[model samples]
Target: MSTIYDVAKEAGCAPSSVSKFITKHGYVSNKLGNKITAAMAKLDYHYNGLARNLSTKTNNRIGVIVPFLDHPYFQGLVNAIILEASKISKEVVILPTAYNANREQQYLQELEHNMVSSLIITSHSLPYTKIYPYQRFGKIVFCENSNHQQTRCVFNNRKEIFEKLFTTLKQKEITNFGFMFIRNPQDSKTTKETFEAFKKIFNHYPQPERIIYNCRTAEDGKNGYLKLKRTIPNLQIVLSESDISAAGAYQARGNSDTLIIGQGNQLVSKLLRFTSIDQHLDETGILALKLATEATSTMKEKVNFDIIWR
Candidate 1:
């Protein structure tokens, strides 16, 4: 309940001197500074972040928007961003939208009101047009591919990575394929690009009969495999969107000759001993943070990834 005025009165200094000492905006004698510090401790005074930020016209905080926090892929990304932000003494505020467009828009509106200095969008349900209008408020950076002119985008080459994955599978003499995707191909850019790559490489084979959708967890992976086995009957390979799902598939399929590939190269992938695409999520987080905080010439930036063969 103690305010700057209380601390000032206790320290026998004017409020302006207290403000200068607290905000570090102007020089205060060391004796006065020590007195103010002592008074604050004695009174248990706490500074108001919002009021301070409003007065300074800046918030040493960054907002990160993600679809889910349970997934290791996203958890890794967020952790990396937080670690990098800490180096600059900045804090992170996570806005988990759960793929809700309205929630994302609400956070965007908050950005315009200066709730955060910048926003790092890892996934979004709102279109670029709706998001573009808020760029005047602060830096808006995308962790996925975007063609927005006002904001910067840092993303991986999903299409190219899929193409490489397809090549590797073909070289292994695997033909009949099944893929597990998190969302509808029509709704997800990565899913569409991955499917296209699969089609290009498996042109000689029949259309993938065991395509599974909405596979977001390890249990989904197991259930997807069971479904694929029953439907396709001849499914020889499985590609999953996440390592957690792949871990589930491995559990269901057991030690078999069926080739399995997973994305995100998560800890589960290593434990399951499956080949996975290491998208370098940590690098993505660090780069996204940098782009969000610093000015860059290009509006879009691409980060490279590799397939980690286990």
Candidate 2:
């Protein structure tokens, strides 16, 4: 492998001059730059980005910390972030933690070590106490709601959206509805907001049997629909966590006249011709990257959302 020293020897220039030319950190004369370029072409040399980043204390890479990769919701968000980063000439590194606290902490430590310029945490198991200390290392942006006032986030305004959704549903005389979740109500603020919104509009909390937990895939949604059917035979509607899950319910409800509402307005929702709430994931991702790269205030930015009834 050709190193910087090899390029320097071939170019007959100081290694520092070669470094300056390659990293563009300091000025190098046009003649020295041309020589280094020729030397690199002859030696087929490739500079180490990690080493350069360490020396310059700068990075063009942004890390996105996600909890799960199998779910389409996260997959869509990642794709949006990657596309947005590419437009700005930035690199994206996806770090999956599977909701593991230790793994999340390790990825956060990467920021502390300057391995990543900034991090966009889609979800995490670590508390703010452990994660906040590393803010001194780099910008830490959240893709979901945050309790702390000091943190920066770009999230869907689920509370406002849910309130409007339930109000609309109630006006349509839709009652006896159930909802699915990837996490328990206590663990996710979104789920809690959903519950509150349902209670406010329906004038009562949904029965425990109507709530489905640990739902991430189409299979989970199919099973949840079947389970709810057994309990509440007259199930009128099921609000799915994602369009992927909603597709399952759409398939399982074969001849039933039940309404299947989904979130995220994913491709499946369009193809399956089901109703869904479009959370504007693309916009959220774009804004999250902007927040990480630019000087943004430490406040929660809510992505606009709308319902698509089919």
Candidate 3:
């Protein structure tokens, strides 16, 4: 491989001059700089990013940790973060962990190693206690509602929104409810809060008939509908974690009076003509990136949500 020495020799200058021009650390005459640039182009030289980052103690890259990219909610979040990052000439590295704690820890290790400047955790399986130790590496921001004192969090009032949804259903005279969630019990704070809110509102109903757990995809939603139909014969309302799942349930029900409410007002929800919670996930993504870059005091920023009634 052609080295800086080769480029310097080709440009008829010293290696220090070539290094100064490439790293922009010191002054190099325009004439010599042009020669070095021409020589580098002739040799098809590429700068070693790892070596540069190691020497500078910085990188123009941000690491985002998400559960998965298949869901529209996550896609929207990632896209917004990427868009915002691009405006500042930064790049995002998405690390999908599929709710694996060990994989999340691996990404934390990457942060510690200075592979990226900071980390935006959209969703993580690791507990806050385990993740807190890594703050020494770089800025770690949570994109979900959290009470952790170690990191800044940007999230919506999901519990309040769920209460509003339940109240809306009650006002519509709908009692028999079926709730679909993406995460397992105790796996996520949102899931736990949502279920608790559901229980609080529907305390009179049987627990088994009211929940459809692990509804991560559209297929799961369809199958969950089938199970709910067989079990809860008089089911009047269905709420799903994502619009994709709600679309599946809407397909299974096929033009019924059953009220379907979807979380994440995605395109599928609009096409399916169902009411959905617009959590402004794009805004969440932007805020997450901002917090990760700005390094504010450990704080929580709550974004409002709206019900996109069809």
Candidate 4:
């Protein structure tokens, strides 16, 4: 009936210190080590290995909640998180919420309620407010708001991508152009930054109003392309926020005469011969794992990931 909590109190040490001794996880002073051992024996404690480890030490469970796993972007990031977590001493429990607030909330609740030790959340549908309650329970983090000292923001720089993209456009002397992007919420930090960069370079030129489209599914590529076609019917040159969006535009209208550049070098972008920026999926995921390890291993401060675009 005695839990680690009971043993820790009896040992006159924090639960984490007791956990370190039990799991042989890290260095423990001779005094603390002896205290923990004595507490365990007195309490007749039996380490069920995995169970107690889950509830006591690392919890061995890391939560990953992404917007839409169906998107190659998220899929790649998840792969990195999984691979990195695998290399360490913990296990990952991924919860793909498909950008649903209710779903995101449910996953967060379930992780805490079920005693998941740490969580790395990438919420595209749900805002950060949903996870505010998790600030104290453990290491609750965001993958897109690194500005705050406590909340981790994992992302890449769009300035470099934008700079290269604009240079290409300028070389071709394409004075008039339009930006193809979705509405807000779809407006990620990179998206907004990219738009800002675009305006800086092209605002002076007489270009048409920004062509925005909303996509419902990966299949929305067709619908998105149709919308773009209807507007610029001959929409020759445009910069799209996502690979699928650019591919959709290509699907509705082939890239024969169009210079449609896509961000996020997804497979479709390659197949469609659309130029795109590689957000470094493997690197991003690896960094995410590094953040989780540091946060879980030491719940001190939010980690900062220096993002670069290639």
Candidate 5:
């Protein structure tokens, strides 16, 4: 409950002196500064962040809008961003967009209107057009894909993930394969990357069959599994976009014995004993938060994703 005013009074100095010291804008005598510090400690005074941000033109908070926080990939990313952002004394606000492009754009506008320090967006359904609003605010936007020249981006090497998975799986003596995913571009950096690798590996004669499905909702994976069941009955190998799809495939087959693989490594993937390629999403988030901070504080251009598995 203690405010800066109380500290200023206790220190026998005016509140303006306290404000200057807090913002590091103007100079206060070292002796008076020590007194103010002592008073602050004694009164347990907490600076009003809103007021401070208003005066200093910095929010000290990062706005993060992600589609589907319940998924392992996003949860890992958020967790990583939180941990890294905490180290720098920054807070992260996560708004669930549920892969809705419109809501993602709306939230970006909201963050700008509120003068949040920066933003880290995790989206699958949103395109570059939706991110145009950030231009009006002059805020930094670090989206997925470190390769793309879109001011700011972060994404793993998608093709390398696929190649690694395929090469590793091939070493395990599993050649017959199937790929399951939605025809959406706003998926994962690795999703597209791995798909491309798969395409390259199977571009020869007798390519493996691929089953594509339309994503109905964030929680929709059953249809993908059903589609797989009908297309490639008794399939020995399959690569799925997420844990849900992998679990669905396992259930549809009525066993966990299938060699179904998944990306992002969610709980369902582990529970079903499915093989998976870990994307280190938590690390992705941490790097993203760090990049966003650098972008804001230093006005940097982009922060790239580190390909651990790839």
Candidate 6:
């Protein structure tokens, strides 16, 4: 209920002085500033953020649009972004789309309406062309590899990591392999890069039947493992895009000889003692926020990955 005018009245100072103190737009004497601060504390007064944003055409909130919040990879990125944003007094708004194009488009309206200062899209259902048009409203940063050259992005270096993984498998002479994906590689540039790298290292694409789709949980992994066993019969190795799913695959191996490689290098991977890829997601999140807040050009930064052999 207390406004700047009330604070001014309580402090016996001009309203302009209180306004300057709140906005830090003009100089206010330290002595008067103390009085204004004390008055605000006594009255429990808070500035109207919306009003300020309307006047300045700026917001202190950043929107992060992701497909799934529960996934460990995205969870890490969201947590990192939230922590880093807090240090700079910025608020992070999580927008989960569930890979719904309509929901993703609705979230984009926040940028159009200036509700958020910028958006960091970790994943999406719509293509880059549709998302690219919204950048004119505010800065749009992609956390995955995007085909748009004009959009800013910060992503993990997945291609190099995939090459290293396949090379290691080849060194072991493991030819019959399979892949597990959280989403279809056909729709995801990052996962597509993994397949491209695999093809380059290996002589052929992975068997269509060997690759599993929609593997999010351990149960999905278990089912995927069963399917792979039925189809490949002699599957040498299986690479899962997430550690949770990989853990499931490991459990379902049931004394089988298939080597399981997981992604995310999360707790499940470490506890289970399996090789996993550390995508350096925390760094990607920090860099993505940095680009969303600071970058003016079409900047693309790639965070490195490490293959943690357990």
Model 1, position 276, has a per-residue lDDT of: 92
Q: Per-candidate RMSD vs. true structure? A: 2.2, 2.0, 1.9, 7.6, 5.8, 2.7
Question: In model 6, which regions exceed 4 Å deviation?
Answer: 1-18, 27-47, 295-298
Score each candidate by Cα lDDT.
0.86, 0.88, 0.85, 0.66, 0.66, 0.88
lDDT of 5 by residue, 154-191 (tens): 65555665666676766777776666665433365544
Q: How many residue-pair clashes does candidate 1 contain?
A: 0
**TM-scores of all candidate predictions against the true structure:** 0.92, 0.92, 0.93, 0.69, 0.69, 0.87
In terms of lDDT, the best-performing candidate is 6
| Prediction-by-prediction clash tally | 0, 0, 0, 2, 5, 0
- True lDDT of residue 278, candidate 6: 92
Query: lDDT-based ranking, best first?
Result: 6, 2, 1, 3, 4, 5
Predicted candidate 4 versus true structure: per-residue lDDT over 1-310, tens digit per residue: 8888999999998988988897888989999999989999999987677676546544668888876666566777788788888888678887876566788778777666645767787645655655666656656655655455566545555565575667667777864455665544244665566666666776652244445555434456556556656666556676666787667766766535766667677787777676787777777677666666573443223332222222
Q: What's the CA error at residue 146 for candidate 1, in Å?
A: 0.2
Q: What does candidate 1's lDDT look like per residue over 1-310, in tens digits?
A: 9999999999998999999888888999999999999999999998887988876779888999999998777888999999999998888999999899999999998788788889999887788888988998998999888866667988788878778888877897877788888877666877877887777887643355678888988999999998987887667988898898888898888766777888888878888789998889888998899988876776777888788987
Pairs in clash, predicted candidate 3: none
Residues 177-275 of candidate 2: C-alpha lDDT, one tens digit per residue: 878889877667668888888778778877888889998899999988888888886899999888888888888899999999999898899998999
Which ranges in model 5 have alpha carbons more than 4 Å from their true place? 1-55, 129-143, 146-150, 167-178, 182-191, 204-223, 255-257, 266-272, 295-310
TM-score between model 5 and native: 0.69
**Residue 113's C-alpha lDDT in candidate 3?**
87
Candidate 1: stretches off by over 4 Å: 171-173, 203-209
Superposed Cα deviation of residue 157, candidate 2 (Å): 2.0
lDDT of 6 at 266: 94
Which tens-of-lDDT digit does each residue in 1-310 have in candidate 6? 8888999999999999999999988999999999999999999999987778867888889999999877888999999999999999999999999999999999999888888999999988898888899999998999876756777988677898889888987987987888889777778776788888999998677767878998989999999988988888788888998999999999999988789999899998999899999988889988999999974564898889999987
